[model samples]
Target: MARINVSQLKQACVDRGWLDRWLDDPATPVPMPMTPAGGIPVNGRLFHQLVAGLVQKLCVPDASAPLLALRSREQIWALLWDELAAAKVQALVRSQSAEAALHLAEALKAWCQRLAELRANCPNFKSWRSALLTHEFDLKRVAIQVSDGGVVEVSGRPDSVQVDPVHGIVVVDYKLSRGSNGTLDLLQLAIYARMLRLAKPGLNFAGLLEYYEPGLHLVPKTEAQLNAIFEHEVQPVLDRIAGHEKLMSKLKSVQVGHEAVRLSWQPKAEPDLGRDIEKAYNSFKVPVQVMGRVEAPQLVRYLIRPGLGISFAKLRSNAVNLKIQLGLHAEPLVMPGSGHVIFDVVKEKPDTVWWQDEVQRAELTAHASPLALALGVDINNRLILADLCDSNTAHALIGGSSGSGKSELLKSLVATLVKRNRPETLQLTLIDPKLLTFGGIVENAYLTGPILRDIEESLACLHLAVEDMERRYEILLAENHTRLGDRIAQGKTDLPFRVIIFDEFADLINSGREEKKEFERLTKRLSAKGRAAGVHLIIATQRPDKDVVTGQLKANLPMKICLRVTNAVNSQILLDEPGAEHLLGRGDFLSQTGSTPVRGQSLFIPQKEFLELFADKI
Candidate 1:
């Protein structure tokens, strides 16, 4: 058990993947830069004192001056200065004899101007004329029990609380700096709202960010949004803090350097690919020029400019010869286009992209849309995300042959989805016929049901998805909201996005005709209307054929991820054209979010690490 503040809890959850650090040292605050615009230095203490003095004089209710009512700029400044002097705020700012003192004066003047403009321009400010305001609201110690038989006594002091005509009890925090930290700011406000709700169960509490800007740039969040923030972003950190000993023990056993199958590798240098391409072209007398090249963890692409009057078809016809001359295991890929003929060659020693590194590097937050799926990194080292919220990428069809890392991709998808979102916001229905794909998975908080192995159970799971979609649609119609997100914003926090990850879809559909038809009907219905209802499907298979992936199914699943297929026919079956057959195996994949396909390396998380990371859930 430990005593902590809302700010400390927020810092612990700043990196959700590593909350154990907070248990080791609870007093240290997360560091933030204090520099203002134009490279001007700032004294943090002085700025806080000035802002506190201004807010006390202006926002708080006073018998002399009105509450949040606009006065002449000069009059307001005079009042604020008087209040600060009477309070004896700080000697540094009182002297006004140094650069820091000058900066504080400029800041105070800016605040006065912004306040004036806000009062005159914003309708909400006008409405707050009769609002009841409380400054420096204190939250006493509240003990919350954790799973590890420990209690955490949480406390905080929010800047202000206002009861307005429109929004009920609102917890407000003032931000005077130009820079913004979306994660920290939102967490602090949400924590305050939670504390207020706990104290006054009858009052509806919301969160607001009143920043220093012209015309009152206010960021208001509804009650449901705050609840979600507390559950997803705040509660998990508290749980980890309580159970840090067990988690740290598991983490200690994980040998991060164990490399039976290295999931992270970067080659020192790329093979002499440009020279090899020149030699290949010389043998064929095609007169092609190597314009440029781009290197990635999995593959290196060499951009070629054919000699004047050389057609793209001519270079495409020489792909086989080039592959043989360069001694490539996979076919040399010449993507379809009328522009310069780009050649993609697999690396001799391909790199294995690890999920742990990418997750930290991206600095992803749990507050992001639950449907945002991290689809590895591209050759340009950019994160490839497939937002299931969009129509085009609502449902996906993933195809690969043996040794194509199809199972690894599925594992990564499931792991990242659960890692980045809360169980209350995201739920998963895993249908693994192979069992080998998700065998390591156990009962977790994010699961909609147990890992289903039988075809009948899998179909039943899909049927439930269809039914859930219909029920949600009814809710939308009743609420007059077109999207699930809109309904949730209206305080319907119980609804979560349901994602169905079907491993070896071909096996499920290759059963009897009755089952196949039933599965098809359920999948097609869901795919057509799932995005609006917050339901998504990720169908993966090693068998890419007409039997498993039908025309109707392909039409609905526009987004496709194709790995190293057996032949061009299988590749064409997945991508609506050929090219995937030449993909470098072991996590190399091409995702077709739009018309064209882009190559990327899928992240690989070892089974041992995944189990260790989610041991509590299992």
Candidate 2:
């Protein structure tokens, strides 16, 4: 029998959808496939060596030893620098490449900086340092046989393992790569835990996946949990490999007559079938081989070569191009690094759930307690409810091109606010230059004044809002209160929450120099201090150019909702990121209230439904 390591096991699981097929039907026999012999990338090997060397030096300090106790931070830094320089020299000697050495040197500097930051911020730094010196640990390669006669052997070289009597054996593996932890890393840690448990049955074990880039990620897993994963996920796959079954069929390649082949796909009975197919094909920069077509309606299939599946990054790029060409919503379903892709044209818009839905109404009615605002359904089809006071009351900036569903989103937001609160509790100041966007809600009694359509009237309304904000602040100071919410809670004055909706803010800003400066001043003041006074602004614009959106305007508005835009530049201007350009239109948008952006599909409210909901009030 041959010896197998955790890497071999992981490769077997990933080769040609074998694991997915086995999980789908465990009784079905599958061939015992050999793991492909592929060389690890040069960068990967270097990262491994760097992590191992750092762990051996930094994580194994001995305080009781005279030489180790005399070491200061500067001395430790010098030692680390020397080790890194030696590693770089070794890499250059082996590869004869200066580029590789330079890369390694830069990585070492980054790792050193990260370590210093960790030392400064970690609360348990003292205890952690003490434990490093006192704990019994091993940092060497080990092999263990799982079954009798060595039918199954698993070998791994853990970065570090500390044997603590209180916390059992702690296995730590380092990941130098960026991004969130993946399944393979977790599985490798679990395998290490399993190997340790098998080698020393009396001792308990725990596993951790640690990263030393950007920040620290210390992920710990219990021995029982790891054992359970081994039993359910790892053991079954191993048993099947031992059984030896037939191999799964490979994907068939299509023969093309021309050097460049153009394939067309049409969804049956779909009105926009041709348009959708054109957009899908145009999305790819390089021509794709159309393997075959599926017989399902509204479905188009394309064969992706093995190990050549489109990644999310590539998909986002393609989506940006498609948005520019088609100017319509397109949702492509492709798993990162899969063997195939499907472009399904949505036949109709997603069904609209009424405000009268009992569950939805109940959720809305309960919003008074926390002052939460129901945004809409997210991309995952989950209801997105956010606290206005917490997430967006400071201010909001919205941007999208024409036909990108900005109007619909604004309408949905207003409807949500009105459905939940009475006129006495909430008031809206709506400004629509087009006059048609907010016409449906003009008759609502909650309006601070009838939706302002004239430019002068709109400007006056905004100025009044600024004055109102100042008055609220003075009231707070006089009452010895810090915030409006706090004043309201103490039963001071029942001033309704103010939400000023500015549709087509670009129109107002582009009106003249005077309007632009005045709007900028009032908006800056409101955005800076309005959240504490319970005043929020929701401003929308079709043009997101620098001159129109302006730096001063964006600096004030912290919460941004960006629908599909024309290009990456526009997307960056709107959200300070490039993802908004890749948004599928028709209210598919990215909401950025904090550092990370949340993707969601804005709720759609048909005019008929809107009229029905506000019939008596309007």
Candidate 3:
């Protein structure tokens, strides 16, 4: 509570005739109400925290909330005045309509949002009220005139009493909810204006009401509004103190206006994987830019599933000529009427080498932390996978069967990376064809993606990425960047080392067999040209069949890792040898990178630990 001297407030009221008139009027004895500051029933330090939190969040000066310093615990009018706001919130949570209570919780969230707005929009001042620094209304200067011709002291802390630029009074109060009832209403603003005017004689002041729920509303004070305030609002609070209908009405409004409250429950739609997938595929648009002459690059729309498409464009600008010189071959946009033929390779037919380079050169460098826990591993024996560059190599590959630690490894890896870097520095571009491991991490700031639950969108992303690679290569060459680092040094800051990680690559590969020709062409191109162009790939699968693990793919990817396999044959197919079959089945694995297969333990870090690591950074 900000200790405001009660006697001083009484003196101000008496000096200004505010208290004198109240005592003189036999009908209007001022009821001793609780102070606005330190009005919370809470005690000790917890109460202090509550008051400080209010100062931090709500006291912004924008023609409203003009108090330079306001500290109090009283919650006479249920506006979530303090931690006490939680009681009503908790009650709502326990109600049959618990969801509605959750809506009211947004009050706190709104405060936070308001604070953020103040910080971002306003200059850094010592205090929020510094913006419209106003003079205080000395309530203690007024003395109440008793009907018996005697003086009585009046005491009550106004929410905020400030004179506007014109020396007019302005009083502000925040509300969690409001009601339309003629009595005990949000029109309570009128009363504030009237009283302040009464205390200050010829001064003009407006009543300000800042509402949180049922949305924001401001009923400004006019002369008529002021007259109504004194006659209706002020008199009611003073005379009918026992009823407190207005305050109680506000509490009811908060509950009635609760957004979380739902009338009845309805079953959520069952997932239609096939239909959703069709919509995704249909939404794919691959726009081939023939000097924008194609008229349509591709018309892409929202999709229920992830998918792919193709587009093509020509090289007239400096960027295009740049990529052609840097060993990058443009993909053929083969839609007949689409008219997006790119390279002017008239004499020589576009060879498979182009695809070969494109796919094999895809060096997916992922920042990673190895899985420390497996079927039998405990906390003490958790393994640590190596970390990748926050900006560049935060991507990796997994080749193993069902028994492999593919998902487990991914979890550990994600947890570690998040711990190491903030959302701005480290990002997770996930392509989970299995759609399970990273589903939980589909939060506001972490994912760079389609969430990959949709198959067609995933394919579309691949298409876009392929086209983007072509675009980047062109841009890189134009900027004289033979590589991404070179590009950055020369002020070409647009490009980021995109690590395209596809989990359960087996499913992705198998599902796209109908588009096998395109897959082969795209993968080959990704492998051949992607690494230098800053586009990397992490293709994983439980199945290591010949068709799924094509010969072209194995040749291009230089780094590889594997976990336990079901059989020696599966191990051989995945690792090109037999060590994977010997893996201990958890964090234990045979990781092959730079030509040598090393047996090591993965680092085990819990998700909570991981978040705690970079929580401050974000």
Candidate 4:
């Protein structure tokens, strides 16, 4: 049973080239690349070695050992400090810079201080010491064969492994970092336990990771637990490595050409290389430029059998140049060549559901509820519907920059509601200060009144909405109903759900101090108390600043829909997250009803289609 070091397994997993190089010639020794000169200086390696050495020394049975014979915690710390100082001087000599040496010295001292603190403060230190003193564990380096096929070398002896009286073989590995335990480290411990089981059969094993920083951190796992993790987590990795090795073994030749590079493989090999090609292309965005009488470089040919090979060289030079111009590290590029036969590839376009499209009309009219407002189709082409009633989206705050499809989203919302519900079931009051946004739908039967174009009229409409909300509350109280939905359910009233939409809410809020105060007051009132009374607000603003979208207003409007904002600050103001800034605009938006935000592409409806949808009514 050949054993590999745990560090070697980790390195193999991270670097594909490591496995490829090793598999090519098992006997060929490959020296691991060191970090480039002048990289961020770190003494982590020195400290790790020092700690491992100390643990090994302390594990010795001899009572006269210097580390074990230390009387006080200070003496143990002082001894460890001396070892660190010696290692630090060696590192400093290699570094050759006084500044680098100082930084290394300071880092080592901090680590030593932290170790001392852990030894003094941690309650588990005594148990750990007792286990190390009592147990006779295997030396650090061990090897085990993966179930898939290959044998991996895992280095590092467990700090201590005890054949416990009741809990079986307990293996402990010391971690000298200052954070939560990492998964890889725990997996390494599990591997150690696995190796121990194979080496000594009929012994149950348990793995523990002892983190000795900030405080003593202990993670204990039984043999069954470790085995489960190895099967679920480590097995898949080994399988992938085997698959990759097989694929690389079949590679016959790689021809690097001026226009394109071609890859030829052995007979009967079909490697999934599309992902690797796509990853290289995505590193830098380059335009496809065609040479004289030739079409642009595209995925020209792909052969799946008789050893699959792909030829791509068309735009390789162009992509490389673009990467250079952008000051980015260039990845190897392979594109279609000029001599390759060009196929007329028809790229599948996104399905455009226009406002007047019969399909959209059917969707809206099919089991439509006044509470559910359909936003748009998501990236998956599923209709993104938000329930104003159940989702606490009774009042929504929307923010987006110009050309972010803010107006289109508002139009879609209005058109969807109108198409779904009768005028008696839904009513809309639109305030478009810019006048151009909601003018097309002004004549819709769902409109409670004409679109308010002036700021003064918008303010007046908000005041009227407050009055309406107060009236509805009064009616609900008088009728002995808690909510408008309850009243309608009991056949108490036929009051329709009123949705007041304000396009460019910033206009009203930034008009004047007096107007801002009044507008804020009315908006806060409606957003807070209007949900139960069947009144809702959908406010859109291009400017999502602290001044415009105030804390008071934001707190009241729980449902936030943010399109592509100018910066992360605006995104935070809108969705309380830093993602809206990264939105690919012209319909992309992040809608947050609760904590998590859902990204969706708003439905695009051209003005022509919008007018055609309402041609009869208008």
lDDT of 1 by residue, 433-503 (tens): 76888887788877887889988788878888888999999988998887886666566668887889988
Predicted model with the maximum TM-score: 1
Per-candidate alpha-carbon RMSD to the true structure: 15.3, 15.5, 30.9, 16.4
Error of 1 at 152 (Å): 46
- For model 3, how big is the CA root-mean-square deviation? 30.9
The parts of candidate 3 lying over 4 Å away from their true place are 1-396, 415-427, 489-493, 610-618
Q: 1 or 3: which has the higher lDDT?
A: 1
Query: How many clashes show up per model?
Result: 0, 1, 92, 20
Error of 2 at 209 (Å): 21
The superposed Cα distance between candidate 2 and the true structure at residue 576, in angstroms, equals 5.0
Off by over 4 Å in 4: 1-351, 356-368, 442-444, 489-494, 612-618
Lowest-scoring 10 consecutive residues by lDDT in candidate 2? 243-252
The 0-to-1 C-alpha lDDT of every candidate, in the order given, reads 0.73, 0.60, 0.43, 0.60
Off by over 4 Å in 1: 1-265, 363-367, 489-491
Rank candidates, TM-score, best first: 1, 2, 4, 3
